[model samples]
Target: MNKTLVAGALALTLAGCASQQPAPPFTLTLAHINDTHSHFDPSDARLTLDHKAVFTRLGGHPRLLSHVNELRRQAEEAEQPLLFVHGGDAWQGTGYFTLNQGAMNADVLSRMQLDAMALGNHEFDIDNQRLAAFIQGVNFPVLAANLDASHDPDLKGLENLKPYVLYAFDGHEKERVDSVKDAGKRPVVAVMGLVLEDMPDMAAHTGNLRFEREVDSAQRTVRALREQGVKQIVAVTHLGLERDQRLAREVNGIDVIVGGHSHSLLGQFSNLGWADGAPYARQFTNPDGRGITCVVQAGQFAQAMGQVSVTFTPDGRVSRCEGGNTLLSDNVFYRDIRRGEQHRLNEQQTQRLKAEIASQPNIAMVAEDPALRAHIDKQYLPALNRAYGEVIGHLPQALKHVRLPVDGSGSQIAPLVAASQLYWANTPEVLAVTGRRADFALVAAGSVRNSLEPGALKEGHVGLELLPFANPISLVSLTGRQVAGLLLETINASLPADAHTGKFPYAAGLRYTFNETSKGRGYLDRIEFLSQGHWQRIEPDTRYQVVLNSYHASGNDGWSTFFDSQQAFTDRLDLAFTNGKLTAFPVARLSKVNGGGVQVHYINQPLNCQDQAVRCNTDARAFIDYVRERRPMLTALPESGVTLKRL
Candidate 1:
């Protein structure tokens, strides 16, 4: 053979040899779900214009199982190893979960075959013993490197739970290589779980367990796993996304962090940079520096599942990855029978799941308790009768009632109820009015669950009818400016004239108006405070001792302004009522107006219909309009003017 031809043949042979070499890497799929909260049934059903039933379907364990099965099948088809994980908060949100001590949730979770679960605060809502029982019942491990379970009775049993788990997936080629190579050649993946440090206070009732900071616990776990020969590390974090990001940046060795708590919808993995001091942005970095750490979370409820697929090269470094969060609810595989459309789960599978749910007893207890039923009979109804005693007067006709006015503003009902609560509390030197003040009475209209009727007034009715979700009274203090800011935020967030007719409204004794056209966000452009018996301008710098429920005081519903104030005081509202003096008086007559200094009037229009305008000022009119619009949207309105006193 010619020398040139032989040289060309040798080069071709070398090229063929290179083509026969092993493929690049192996891929693994990580599937995760969080905050299922034991919602066995779907959301409520409403009728559409087509007269067809439209259901807001949501979480159910069986449906979740169906989703897992499908995802596993897809992963298998794609030649990826699948690992299922849970980012906790699986217990105590619903009635069934509470009543069963999390048994139902545990059963469902075990059935799903979860590989690991990060401890969530709600897991400790039940006592430690029950939590231990739940842990014993589950087949999978609860991962929490931070939870100190040594001393507490409730958490002592958890000492057996592993802080981390390592998984090995061997594909055909890897298996062949393993058989030919040394025994230590198999590839392994490690997962670590870390609970949030705030779990101790949040889940205080669960037991006397202590939790270290998430970042510290995660760092220790990563070090330990690395020592144990873990090639790839994933941290299952139950901390909120903010803390999760902090963990990803602070902890160096983790390859991926599956996080929960804040219910973030992370569609795909993203880079989280270190704190301002770190040298570089925190990215996924494997042992060999071939890949970056990926972090992901699926939103609350079982509405969606998160998938992270990572491919590892022969050297144990992640080479390539591709995955996205998927919404099982939108899939065509499960049919939404209520929608009259064939969608996801086949009819047989759907029925079986439904049967499984139906077989479970006491699930309805998740929403309402039998104790509430008893209270309605023995305590609530009688209290209503006594409070509304001696029919003072009667409505001329059956007038339409609204919880709040249609306009985007505050409702009168909330302040009225707050005043009633204060009256019941009978605090010494307490200022009683429907208005805003630092260390003064403030209540949200959304907290008012019932309304009064248009019939003859009777005793006990006010106690029974007005607010059904009678929360324990909580008190908090704030400055006048802080109070004002809270009120403004509530109104601005609720009523933007450009939005819908009915939105959340603010109810206060202080008079306030906004120029919907001029003021950005339409906050309190016009403000008045009730003083002695007249409306007066409120000074921004003034400080006042305010009494409000913990709900509003804690800045729920955009009331963060309260938190920005000076020194604040707090106590339960129910305790305030029970401990303070109480008095009962006869209802001589119903007055159109109570003690007031600030009067509210609509800027351009009547608050309500002429016939319904008897006591309708601007505040009342705006509230009526707001309520009228939202009536169709709510399940039920607060029983009008009814109050419940806890003794």
Candidate 2:
């Protein structure tokens, strides 16, 4: 009797424990990519496998789509939640975007049936008229809460664009269809769109549209979404990672943030095999003391896709979250387990990882997507070939800077570009807008896409290398003091303090000496501007003209000084009003050239649709025109780093 009573007691205790089990939590798996930049191609990228360098095809749309689908299959099998998101800048970058004007990208991305996408600044590169047309191809909603486009009739035409949207997705063992939730209904997820308010500074600004404050728009959106019983709110944004973190902390009810614009790499060092970058997903708590918001970004060009698994409590609070980026390297990754846990993926695990990765469908290892390539070959390639394939000039020696040590310097291309841009800015066509001739040239080292190679260089090579984005050249007037200050900043950002700085200023008719002891604006020992055949000291407050690509003049890369002077710029280089006494060439009168050459590029002028008037306006065309004028053989620069020096 005693033994039976003991057994019964134990059974009753076990029964109580079984009855008190935890509730089933709502789970979601977010698969995302950002800043694709129309890289619908698989290019050769170098990586280390088993401690040795290996060349591999890193990314392409087909491979990216296959990876996404593979992950989707895995998620569905496990009954985990899944959502595919793009961070933005879907257009602008490669030859693909330049030739097709984002149509091909739109067509391809639309086929993915994306849940949502933020309107990146590059989306406005073609202006509002083209964006509206691009929207027509997208089946999914393209979001932006801050941009007030209702005033623009062209934007008003697109009925799909809105401040925020509601999406109902069920992750539990129940439904397949993800649709919009109705009033008073429960939603598995609700995503809102928020774009950076500084559109005027970043993209092509329009008169009819204005941007609202990001935080204010986000807070209002969260409050509205919450009132409708929306529990999980994800913010798809182009405000970049830093701002995303602040937005998550300052605003309540944001459960996740998918972002772009910085083209940053964020992931764990152990899992990612990269030491520098933000973790794949970082959790931030709101100041209001509510649920935490998880933020993530998949690096540029679909190189990797971030997969996040999140569990939320019944009351819409985050319970737990975990995930990281899956490197779409399309090659085997190996690590020695003998090293430690930090290494991750030993022999067996690496094999399993590679095998599983290989199981997914993929295309051949080529620089471009097969679909895009076929499309290009069929139509676009013919035009580009006919337009830019001619052997207009020859490079006797290869010009490169990839291995240079002058603070992220490239080969001879750096000085060559500085010479070429300065040459064009001095040209009759480019000089008219500013009403002043360029005294010197300034270019960012990062602007040299690839070094010019030896042998026969076609016009296409120019597009391939220097003008991947075809940025137009422009001129800016800076005081000698401002030029000195700019050089000081550039030197401070370089080694022995920071080894590699792509922002290192490359100048043709300019040079600066610096002392390592000082920093900030005083690092430069002296500044010089080459005028005629002599070098003269750059005096503070004395006006000097600097010519550069649109990238640098817009204060992108590192040259931050120019950001304050953005409005003073004219349409490229144009002869315009009143910059002193208009000494020489046709004041306020535009120059139309005679029939010496057929112009394929849009001439830089002070009009909104200046680029639209021509087929191309790339740095390539400018450099090509420069080379053709001095053709037969191009002269190479001095052997050593002769652009600058230490006093």
Candidate 3:
């Protein structure tokens, strides 16, 4: 061979080797929001890293759009594929959604250009017709693999609701193959979605729909996507964090799981192998073993946006993943107040957007009437007073002021309502009663919405606070054993001793002692049921007709033990009571007696008002006098007459 030929061939061989090398990994960015629930603005307050609190000034739709646009700009500059997704519960929180059947919020969501969203429980609040109408207006796909809309005539039109979608970047294959063993270009990217299995029951009011098994639906969807020649897969799920993790571990072939529902803030990669005793064994190799599925979710209410970037190898395995939740309203992101005109410019820009939207006819409907709306100042006090008047015999003190933290028992008005219902049901028709049956109730400290001021209590305010959610009463038949099991579960679910020292159940016709340090859930040592003005032991084998809010009857508060017992004769408790007939119930007077006067014999702890911030420290007679003077109009009741009639 000649020297020239040899040199040329050698150069060609080296060029071929370089071309066969793997292509550089590309990054795909996913932005997500969940449980927005019509909160177009930031929460009650925005917190800083230094723990300094600042009231939010900019959180309306316009500001959010600006922020989203900015993030898209930055993502585009980075040459990353960006996909915007929502985790569900987009409608039915405030007047913006409820009053208009989610019309305004749907318009806003459409304008925002959501790429995909999962089905949330609240989406069904308005029924199937309204849900379908809302979905029809949205440009993006509403993904729910488990929901069977075939049976529902209203939702049958939502044929566009798919389990998954595939987005492919053309010409990516040639580059990837040239860089890796001289193969062809990379395949298309696919994103799948799954809704929670319990969505049907949870969202029963929204529509007449049903959800299938989540794991089965996910498996089927992943298989179909793989069959369609789409290798890169992303699962946007509304099954919550724990269930999402479970889905990731059980369902194979899924590359990532974008989670929602539980509202977890997950940006960094967390190993799901620990779930269900699975080991963190990498299933595929991409030069770097980044694992099979990457899961991420943003917290509820658009408080933060999640950014997840994943790199896929030519062979379709994830090489790397990185992301974080960006604080939309931080000092760094905003113009400093000290900047004066600059800050004012941002404010002006925000105001202009708000004005543009505010000018719309729908904005007038969004404005809530404080008079009718349930707020601490307007509704809770009156309801509390009515319940107290019906249950309590007399005011203990001359002033009869029920101080906040009423008895230093860590009980609240809701629990008191539960207790009152229990006490009311303690007749011959109701053999035995357990659960939240007390005139003086205590809910989880987290449940109390607000505190009352030192003044006369009114029926209106009490009604507002007690019945804020408009949940009706329910009655359930349970054996004595089942009742005892439920009490144990309630104690087990309460806060730990070291976490919050003072905790007590709201008492109606009963009082009990609980030892927080006890193990195995049997924390209640002695339960005393009041009979003929005396405390007595409750028999364990007798049947009882217990009355409670529908929320509790269904075992929402870790009272699953009650339902697990398979008791019979479950009925709506609301059917047993009449509205307005119990109007003169004095909550303040009841609080004054239950607040501190008599130490119920069961628990050694003395009843004293500890937390002044929440207790009702107002003169009962004076508050009633004040109510008479002000005479706020009563809310119009439904056609149901005022009488305690059983359903």
* Tens digit of per-residue lDDT, candidate 1, span 1-647: 89999999999999999999986576778888887666543332221211222233443555566667776778667666778899988864433452355776776677678888988866865467777887888988888888777767666756436677666666422221111123264566777788867553233253456667777777788777667666677888887665666666667777777877765655422221101111111245544444456677776566567777776666455565555554443122232333434544556654544443344321111222233334334632343334443543343322332333444423435655444443333333322422223333556664543334334533223222333222334334445676567766665554432221112333333555554444335445655555665767767787554544443443434555643342232221212221232111111111111211111122233222123312211122222323333332222223322221111
Estimate the lDDT of model 1: 0.51
lDDT of candidate 3 over 500-609, digit per residue (tens) = 11111243444566544543233566765556677667678866555554434444334454344433323322221123121111111111011111111112222222
Model 2 TM-score, all chains together? 0.74
| Global lDDT of model 2 | 0.65
Best model number under lDDT: 2
lDDT, each prediction = 0.51, 0.65, 0.49
Worst 10 residues of 2 by lDDT: 591-600
* Model with the higher TM-score, candidate 1 or 2: 2
- Candidate topping TM-score: 2
Question: What is residue 384's positional error in candidate 1, in angstroms?
Answer: 27
Summing lDDT over every window of 10 consecutive residues in candidate 1, give the lowest-scoring window.
589-598
- Winner on lDDT (1 vs 3): 1
Tens-digit lDDT track for model 2 on 1-647? 69999999999999999889865777888888888877776544444444443344567676677777777789777866688888888886566676788787888788666878899877877767788888877877888877777677778747678766665555423232233344224345777788867665445334467778999999988888778667788888987777898898999888889888766667643322343567667899998887798988876776777788888898888878778766666543324312234544556756655554444322222233356447546755576566557787776655555422445233577677777777876777655544567888877776665555456777766775456655656665778877877776665655432222456777788876655553322366667788897988988888877777765665554566765444333233422122322212111212212211111122333323243434234356667877878654665666323334332
Residue-level error in angstroms, candidate 3, position 483: 2.6
Segments in model 2 whose C-alpha atoms lie over 4 Å from true places: 1-23, 172-186, 205-207, 268-275, 331-388, 391-416, 426-437, 444-457, 464-472, 484-506, 512-526, 531-536, 550-572, 575-618, 625-647
Indicate the residue-level lDDT of 398 in model 1. Answer: 26
